[model samples]
Target: MQIVGQTTQLEAWVASRTRKFHINEILIIEDRDHRHPKAEVIETRTFNRYIPLASEQSNLVDTSVLEGLRSVGFDIEDEEIHLGKLRLIEELPTPIRVGAPARVPSFAEVEDLLIKRKPHEGLTLGVIQGSREIAKDMPESLQNVALLFDKENGVGEQGGVPFVFDYRSMDQYPHIGIFGGSGSGKSFGLRVLLEELMLKQVPAVVFDPHFELTFDQEFPNLPEDFRHSFKKRFVTLDAGEDIGIEFSELIADDIVSLLRASSGSITDAMETAIKALHKKSDSFLTYSTRMANLAEALDNEKEIREQSRDEYLNPNDRERVKLLNDLLVKYKDKVGGFSGTLRSVLRRLTRLEMEGVFTSAGTKKVEEAFAKRQLVVIRGSMYFLNVFAFYVVRKLYRKRRDYRDSIQKGRPVEEKFPPFVIITDEAHNFAPKGDVPAPAKGVLKEIAQEGRKYGVFLVFATQRPALLDDTITAQLSTKLVFRTVRSVDIAVIKEETDITAEEAARLPYLSSGTAFLSSAITGRTTAVRIRVSKTTSPHFKNPFEELEEGFAEQDEKVWEAVLPSLPIDASNLNAYLTEIGRKVGRLLSFDELEKTLEDFVDQGRLLKVSTPFGARYNKA
Candidate 1:
């Protein structure tokens, strides 16, 4: 079936490569030479499918050619799949003299030729079952289609041949972590990958800190239906709201871990205390035992308020005291002696009513708010802190465990606990590797170790990887590395992620928005040019640009907006010196300290007017 007048390069290559056995095609990497244009042609014949030697269990027989596949290696008893070559056909016109032609020969159409090649019951030559047609009902607004690749599609070329690490390959390992500097386009890249999975109906949860990812409006210009579908699947958590769960559902270990308490009898007491804290049937004594640790904090507010009342008796202080009194009265019974020393302390501390740390009304409102929303946003609130992150994570874990237990017990669990994604920004603040407060460390460790299976995924973003928990960092199978100037952080990332030294060195120089994307999902070690997100507004702006613009403005814009935010009363000379010392403690070098002080002076916040003994100080 060789064509009559075609060049024999493809045929010759096939003959040379498949000399010993039947091969689909010989794939050659096309050259980019332009001087001799024809030299750029690299013709390779490809097979849709090839029968390689296989064992009882179907695994591909290893060969020199297959070794090029990175990460995944070949096994015996397997089938070999190859890419097919694309042909450029030149359709010839009717050659005969029209009026006097011996016969009007009907030239075969490409589609008909393909159909004719399907020889009954025998090996059919290269033939397609059907052509892919654009769906007539598809809306014009939808601009992109999901890319599908199967055995027949062949290898796609994206400058070079495109490769995919099949889902099957990543089955053995599944944890993932992403890291990048501010405004590095990590969010955009993550969205693309997530969308791909959603289309496949692979259940996934993502914790988004900035609230940029959860809102439908966040991804504008998308087809309405597509947006709706994505939104329906997401569950958001807000820190402002009180997320509720049955205390009894949580295991003692989980409760202890959530609070970052040390494992021992203390944890047991904490767990017991948490379970008894808000139970309807529990006695005041039981309540006290559960919340005893913070009991003293209850009086802290009343004491402060009473002092304020005696000193200033302002209307605000009066109202605060009234609120505190209401809270104390409501929970006074629960403030009695508890089991564990810490539990008892917490119980007493939490006894303050409206006049206490959390007013009764405030607690109720917070709880009610969290219970209603599927997707919650916890940022942009003054109350949201490192402690808050721990609380939310712990709550979610407890709820998940309770749901599982209910299912096991054949109890009616109406609301399905949807998978959640936890995106922690400035993760070091909550999951610091070294001596951080106990609660943050405990729950974060639990999430890292066990959350993946329970439908919890963590997106930990940090500039300082060296300061992050080693255990949590190690569990991430996917890594997105952006520019990191610190050698320590770069080294930590490289060592943790198994990135080569050459690649590690390049991290410090990565251009803004450029990152090294490594995932088990895409095994090939290749650099990807991230697609710019057209849907979402560019909320993540350059901080330096914002700062420069803010400071450069006149007419009190800078004074009103920036001046009040500074810790020092630049007008007060004594306060300026103390602030400088405090700020300088964080600097890596004395030169930076000096430069910062000079900048402050130049800004007129620190006046450089006079000196004692000719030693000048930056006077506010």
Candidate 2:
């Protein structure tokens, strides 16, 4: 250790004999009072005094004088100095006077600072970036306590340190935000995190619009020992397969929001009609049946009231009259004019019903997953995702909140509804900052504000941070920011995170799989390379590769299915297509079959000719 330069409480400049000091390297400065203040090297520079001196004093200094100085052991040309600029990790208890001795910390001291948390204190996310000495000294307990990812320590020739995080701290901090541009490893990092959660048996619901989170697929290239049994813990609720929510569970507001998302805005009359209908009926089927019956009753009553002459009433006629009168009175109080508004509301509801969203059967209750600690993946379109996410999030969040409240009050709580985390990949769609609120925005906002107290957390991942709701963004306790090219997004990240100007500048240039993690749990902003995922999405394949392998097989099947249907003689295109449709058990439109024939003609597989009966096609 040597005192070479100036020192202060927060920063210092140190001169060293060797240029081995690395960026992000930690150093200890000992004051005269023996108080050791830790500092991290932020910048490094090499100094050569001879170059400046030779440039400025060329006329004053002669070559003979330089040679004489060199002979007398005053050779400035042979001298090189290493200078490091360091930022203090914490304020010194006592201000260090100038010229304090700065020295590299021993492995044990660095280990204590980087690892060795109290038992059950925190989960290891990964080792500190760029520090190999600290990486090798990480405690063995950290390996099993946290999900570990291998990262290159800038100092070493081999082996990586494990980066760690205290997942339990999320209970206090609440939510996490993952922001990155396309191909920035945002999705990949999310998979890694989810896998960790799975290993820990934390229940999660993932809203996957892209249908990518099929955890059944084994992690490619992973050792058997490292692979996880996701099939037992993962459940996929596929929208295309008609998995949906129970219509009886949806209120009028949910219907209105679903309508607005699927179609457009709803008028006041439409809203009133929906609410009235919902009030009258117990379920979707009941609502539809009652509305149809009410419309018929009103029509019959109007016809009878407008009759030119009164007819003698029989017993059946009297009962019919009484029923019509009763129906009119019941609906008139609920729906003022049930003609136009009811028709419009029913039409929209019927359309939603036909879309297979409001179903009694095949409803996947999210509470089931919470009870079992399984990862429930709801895969669907944006519209379905919006509506379903709203319902599930609202229901689960309230249940968890109520359960916690019940426990606090010494009341009976449901054991099935436990603490859970909700994850959304395209989170901006759910909690946007725009004027048109997403269907899930309100519930998501509520959870973001108060979910922490109830053991509910949100992991919102999006490419655009600026578009996310400010309340949700502000509530996020941890942010894993990947490479973002948009200046607006970068500005938002810089404002929200504790990253230095240097780190902010590096955001655009950060390599894929690398991110800047800022969290209250870590108490500092760190740049980390997210680990490789053991499990991958089912659709993780190159389109070109898939097409290359599939095209020939598909072409052969199409030819085999079509050739037998073709006539030996010239036949009209429609006739040939009809025959092929019968053989295939599905009919192709005239335009579709015509296009296929035209392609075959171009490929010399068919011959087309103009005849009196219009175009005629034959096998070539």
Candidate 3:
């Protein structure tokens, strides 16, 4: 150990020796008084004393003269110097005088200074950045906590160290933010974190719009011991597959939000109609029936007003009169008059019904997933995702909050809904910072502010954190930032985290699967290479590759089945498609068959000619 420069309680300049010091490397400083203080190297620089002071002052260094001096017996090489600037992490008991000795800490000293973990304190994430040597000597207690990739030493190497995060820290700071641009391993890191959560048996709901959270598939090269039986723990609510939610469960506000009602009159009118119709019948079909009845009543009222001066009434006048009277009496308060607003609201509601968003049977309840500790992945289009996510998040968060509130008030908790973590990849869409509100935003913001007490947490991942709600962003206690190129986003991250200018400069160039983790849990910023995912997304396959390897085998079978039915002479494309559909015993769309015909022409298997009547195709 050697010290060759000025020192202070907060900072020190240490002379570089044979052992090179790296940025973020921790070092211990000890003076003659025997007081040891810890500091982290933040900057490094090198200088040469061989350059004459007069030459530097004149800004005219003679390179030939310096080279001659160096060629001779001058000690120019010995004058070469390196220095490191270290910021204090731990203060000494007493103020250190100048010329304190600084040295690289031993494994035990490093463990005591930074790597030690309390009992059940934190989950191992990965090794600290720039601590490869010390990482090899991590304590045994943290070895099996979490398996992570070490960027410096590759996967599962000795340089790997336990990066632990205290779970208790979440009580005070609950939410987590994952920010990364495309190909930055944002989703991969999310999957790794999810795997850890699964091992802990924490019930979580993942809003997977792209249907990527199928954890059943085993990881490419993962060991048998690390593999999880995900099918038993995963509950997939796949849209247009097995997923269903009761339409009756949706409230008036939910319907209004779904339609994106902008006008106040339109929203009020829609809400009134929804509440009346929703109360009349719980089934979507029945609700439609009631709406049809209301429209019929409006038509009847118009008819009566126009024909009141008629000398004779219609044969079914009494039935019509009674029906209209009953409808008016029932909906007098709900629908004051059948205006265009009412019609628009009815049209939207009918469209929603046609979209088949709800069902009486096979409705997958959110409570079931929570009760069973299942990782529920709701997969669908953005519209369906937003709707389901809004309902599920709101219902679950409210239940947890109410349960906790009841317990606090000395009242018996009615529902025993377990706490859960809500995760969404496209979180900006769910809780956007724009003026137009998302239905999920209100409840998500509420959870962000108060979810910790209720044991609810949010793990929101987005490529564009700048577009995320400011309130939600502020509430995120931990932010894992992957490679981001946007200046605005980097600025936002800088404002939120304690990353230095040097670290911030590296944000755009960080490798895929590596991230800078800033969290209140660790009480510092760390660079971590995210671990590999045990299961990959089904849609992760390259479509172009699939095509190149021949994705037309199924189409060839259809062509073979239909070719025999085509006449030997030239045939109209539409007629050929119709005959093919009949022969195959399955109705094929004109557009689909037309594309197939075009492909056949491109392949020289069919010839198309513009005849006097129209275009015709024939086997080549």
Give the candidate number with the greatest TM-score: 2
Error at 386, model 2, angstroms: 0.3
lDDT (C-alpha) at residue 251 in model 2: 83
When summed lDDT is taken over every stretch of 10 residues in candidate 2, the lowest stretch is 150-159
Estimate, for each residue in 283-339, the C-alpha lDDT of model 2 and write its tens digit.
887877767766666667676453313466776766666655666777766777556
lDDT of 3 by residue, 174-199 (tens): 89999999989898888877766776
In model 2, what is the error at residue 366, expressed in angstroms?
Answer: 3.0
For this target, which candidate reaches the highest lDDT against the unseen true structure? 2
Residue-wise lDDT of candidate 1 within 328-418, one digit each (tens)? 4444445343334454335333432111222212223323333543333444332244434555577667676677778888999986665
After superposing candidate 3 on the true structure, give the runs of residues whose Cα lies further than 4 Å from its correct spot. Answer: 1-12, 31-35, 44-82, 90-98, 112-122, 144-158, 261-283, 305-320, 325-339, 361-365, 413-415, 539-620
What root-mean-square deviation over C-alphas does model 2 reach?
A: 9.0
Name the TM-score of candidate 2.
0.76
lDDT of each: 0.43, 0.72, 0.70
Better by lDDT, candidate 3 or 2:
2
Model 2, clash count? Answer: 12
